[model samples]
Structures are given as C-alpha cells and as structure tokens.
Target: MKTVVAVYTGQGLADPLKKVFQELLPDVRLVNIIDDSLIGDVVKAGRIPPGVARRLVQYYRNGEELGADVILNTCSSVGEVADDAGKLIGIPIVKIDQAMAARAAASYERIAVLATLPSTLEPTMRLIEKEAAAAGRAVTLVNGLAAGAFEALNGGRPEEHDRLILETAERVAGEADAIVLAQGSMARMESKLAAATGKPVLSSPRLGVEQVREVLERLSREGEAAR
Candidate 1:
C-alpha cells in the first residue's frame, strides 16, 4: 500500500484534508504530521524565517523517512518551500495551492485572495503572480482579509467563521474575476463563497488532493514502465 503523508501547520487544514483524502484517495493510507507553531511563527516573523524554513524541510524529510510515496504540504503560507525541497525529499511533494494558483491565474484577470491571516495572503498572492507570469497573463490581485474568521474557526465555531468569510467574500467578489481562498481552513466555504459572490471561488483542498493523486499515479506508471 502506498502511504501519503501530509505535513500541516494547523489542524483546521489537516483534519478537513484528511476527510477529503478518505473520500478521494481511499486506497492510499493517509498520515499526518503537524507543527502548530509553524503558522504562528510565520505570522510573527512576517515571513518564513530561517529556523522555520529548516523545520519545514525537516518535516517533509521525516515524512519521506516514514516511507511516504508522496508528501503533501497543506499550508499555503509555507507552500513555497515545496518548490525548493521537492528533490531533497526524493518523492513527489504536493504544494497545496500550486494547482489552485495556476487555475486562478489562467481563469481570471482580477484575482481576489481572501485570507484570515496576513502571512497567508502575501504568499498566496506571490504564488498567483508567479503563475500569472508563467501563463503570460498580466493580472491584478486584490487582497481580502476576513477578520475574525480564523479565530472563529479555531475557537470551534465554524459556522460563524463561514459567515464571516461569506460576508467579506461578498464585498470582495465585485472587484474580482474570481475569488481565491488563501487558507486550507477556508476550503469548506467554497460553495457559500460562490453563491454569495456569484463568481468562481477557488480553494486548495479539492485541487490539492487531485494533484496528490496525479503525482502518485504518474509515479506508479513510471515504475511499471521501468519494470
């Protein structure tokens, strides 16, 4: 059996993605390694500082050590590290937001990045910008911060968190060609955000899992070919 390990900085992300994996990647065993401090540390430092970056790489390495066929990094804030660590990990490393960013950049000219955390917003926007350039599209990005949504989600009031996200999303929608939810924790509100915004709402969970599946399948094909 192939084992897929997800390294997450927040349980809000890890738990929901776990559920998605259960439904979508049933045959593959899913494991989680979490470091809650990573998110808070990044937020405080306003960037992935050296220590945190080292830890991020180490976390992925540990996943590979545990016999991970694929490593999924579920936090958008530090998702960029996967771009750097993919080869070092010696397995497919799925950055949760890469597919979403590519889709957003290609689908919309005005991309609205909605996040509850400042740290997440910056990296997600940077990811979108890079994708936009790659696609040869000149894009404008608008940042939307849903105040208190993260707190509500963490405090065990997901409904309230969803409500806050919807309200802010409604306001951000008119200005955006499509809306991108910056954090994996906000993945659950895709439908609500779409209905509330009447535009394409992008979240990482679904697309991220699909990418994980794609990488694993591709590796399986190559292995078969080699044999």
Candidate 2:
C-alpha cells in the first residue's frame, strides 16, 4: 500500500482527514504527525518563525524516512513552508488547502476566505491569490474571521464554533461569489454553508485527499512505465 504521511499543526483535522482518506483511498496507509503547539507558536509569532519552519522541515524529512509516497501538510498557517519544503523533499508535498484555493480562484472572481485564526487567514488568502496569478485569472479575495470560534472549539463548545462561522459566512456571502473555509477542521461545514448561503463552499480535507489519490495514481503509472 502507498503510504501517506500527514503532518498537522493541530489535532482538529486528524479524524476528519483520516475518514476522508478511508473513503477516497482505502488502500493507502495513513500516518499522522501531530504537533499541537505549532499553531500556537505561529499565532503568537504572527507568522511562521524560522525555528518553527525548521522543525516542520524536520518532520517532512522524518516522513520521507518513513517511506511516504506523499506528504500532506495540513495547516494553512504554514502552507508556504510546505511549498518551500517540497523543493527539498523527495516525494510530493501536498498543501491541504491548495486544491480548494485553486478551485476557488478558477471558479469565482470574488472569493471570501473564512478562518478562525488570523495566522490561517492570511496564508489562505495569499494561496488563492497565488493560484489566480498562476492561472492568469483576475480574482478578488475577501477575508472573514470568525473571531473566538477557535477558542470555542478548543473549549469543547462545537455548537458555538459553528454558530460563529455561520454568522461570518453569512456576512461575507454578500460580497463573495463563493466562500472558502481556510482550515481543514471546518470541512464539516462545507455543505451546510453552501446550503445556507446558496453558493459554493470549498473545504480542504476531501479535496486534499482527492489530490493525494491523483498523485499516487500518477506515481503508480510512472512506476509501471519504468518497468
């Protein structure tokens, strides 16, 4: 079985990503590297510190040593680090929100990036902008922060977390052609947000897993051709 190493900055998306992988690529082996403190450090620094980036690169190398066919970086806050790490890592490094950001950039002229943390928000918006620039598409991005939602979720008040996100989405929906949830942890809200806002709502986990599947398939095909 092809091995996928998922490096997470927090535990929020661990179960959800595993579930997505099970549904989308049942044959693949999924491994996780959770560092809950990473997100807190990033939030405190207001950006990814060099030491934090080095630590993440070390984790990616560890995944490589474990024989990962692909590495999934599951934090939008450190997504640019993932991009840089990809250059040094042997296997493909898939940023969890990359596919979602690409889709949003390509499909909508006005996109709103919704996130519970400022650290996640800026990187996600930058990613969408990067995607649009790469595709030569003109896009406008709006940022929406569901303030206190992360704390609520961490406090075990999921209902409050959802409520705050829903409110933020509703308020931003008027300005956006579609809304993109910046964190993989919010994947569960995709359908609900789409239904409530009557617009496309993109989330990372499923799309990221699908992208992993595609990469694995391509690698398999290349292996066969080499034979």
Candidate 3:
C-alpha cells in the first residue's frame, strides 16, 4: 500500500482525517506529521503572522526525505507556505482547504466558510473563492469564525464548542447556499452546524479523504495498466 503524509499544526486533526480515510480507502497508509510548535502560539494569540509560513516550509523540507506520496498541510494558516512547499517537493502536495474549496465551489455559489481560528478564515475563504473562480463561478464567502468554541473544546470543553458553532451557524444561516467548515479539526462540529443552520455542511477532512482516494485510485490504476 502507498503511504500519504499529512502535516497538521497540532490542531488535533490527524485522528479525524485518519478515521475518514480508513473508511474511504483502507489500503492506503495515512501517515501523520504533527508539529504543535508552529500553530500553537499564533492560534493562541489569535493572529496568523507572516513568519509562520516560513516555519512550516522549513518543517516540510526537513521531512522531505520521507518521500510521502502526498503531502497535505492541515493547517490553514500555512497554506501559502504549503503551496510553496508543494512547488519544491515535486509531489501531489495538497492544502487541507483545497479539496473542501473545490467541493464548495461545485456545490454552491454562496458558501459560508466556518473556521475555529480567525487567522484561518481569510485564507480558507480566499482559497474557496479562488477555486470557484477557476471553475467559472462567482462565490460569496462569509466568515463564521468560531474560535471561542474551538478553544473551549481544545481546553476540554466540547459542549462550549458545539454551542458556539451552532450559534454562529444560526447567525450565518440565511446567507449561504452551503456551509464549508475550513479546518479538518472543525469538521468534528459539523453535525451541530448542520442541524443549526439546517443546511449542508462541507468539511475539509471529509473532502481530503475523498481527494486522497481519487489520487490513489488513479495511481493504482496506472500501475495495473502498466503491468
């Protein structure tokens, strides 16, 4: 089985993505590269400054020797740097938000982007809109940052996270055709968001696993065809 590597900035995403992928593509190896150091302070401070991207790029470089089949940056704060790393790595490097962005564009013209970190919202929205435009569609990106709720969850209070996410989704309900949760970590609250907004909820981790499955399937077919 081919292995795919995912790098999450300690947002506690590996398990979620791993679980989704295990069900979706059982044969592939899903490896996690966790770095709590880069995203912790920035998310704690409620800002995603420019330096964080460089740090992420450096981290990916150090792990380049692993020869991961696919490299996914699960931290939205470092997507630009993730793109840069993708350019240098010569592999199918995926931004965690990219798959969700593609799905959002395909599903709705007015997409509400929900994120746990304010720093992640803008980038995630931009990525979604960019994907939409590439598909010849115009998208309206709405910000639904639920940092307080996510912080509460990270602090061992899942109820608070659910409350805040539901509350925020209610506020943004009328404005979107579909709700797109920006982080793989944020997908944990999807059920609550869907119930509150009464709309379809798109999650990165779910789409990321879909992306992995498609790519791996293609690779597998190519190998079989060649033989």
Every candidate's lDDT:
0.89, 0.93, 0.78
lDDT per residue as tens, model 1, 1-227: 99999999866677788788988899999989999998888878988898888999999999989999999999999987878998687888989998999999998899999998888999899999999999999999997988888778778998898888888898888899999999877777788789878999999998999999999999999999999
Q: Give lDDT: candidate 1, residue 180.
A: 96
lDDT of 3: 0.78
Model 3 over residues 102-174: C-alpha lDDT tens digits? 8889779788887778778888888887888889988888888875876797789988887787888888879
TM-score to true structure, per model: 0.94, 0.97, 0.88
Instruction: Output the lDDT of residue 205, model 3.
Output: 76
List, in order, the clash count of every candidate structure. Answer: 0, 0, 0
Pick the lDDT winner: 2
Candidates in order: C-alpha RMSD to true structure: 1.6, 1.0, 2.3
Q: Of models 1 and 2, which has the larger lDDT?
A: 2
- Report the alpha-carbon TM-score of model 1 versus the true structure: 0.94
Off by over 4 Å in 2: none
Q: Model 2, 1-227: lDDT tens per residue?
A: 89999999988789988888889999999999999889989988989999899999999999999999999999999999999998999999999889999999999999999999999999999999999999999999988999999889889999999999999999999999999999988888889999999988999988998899999999999999999
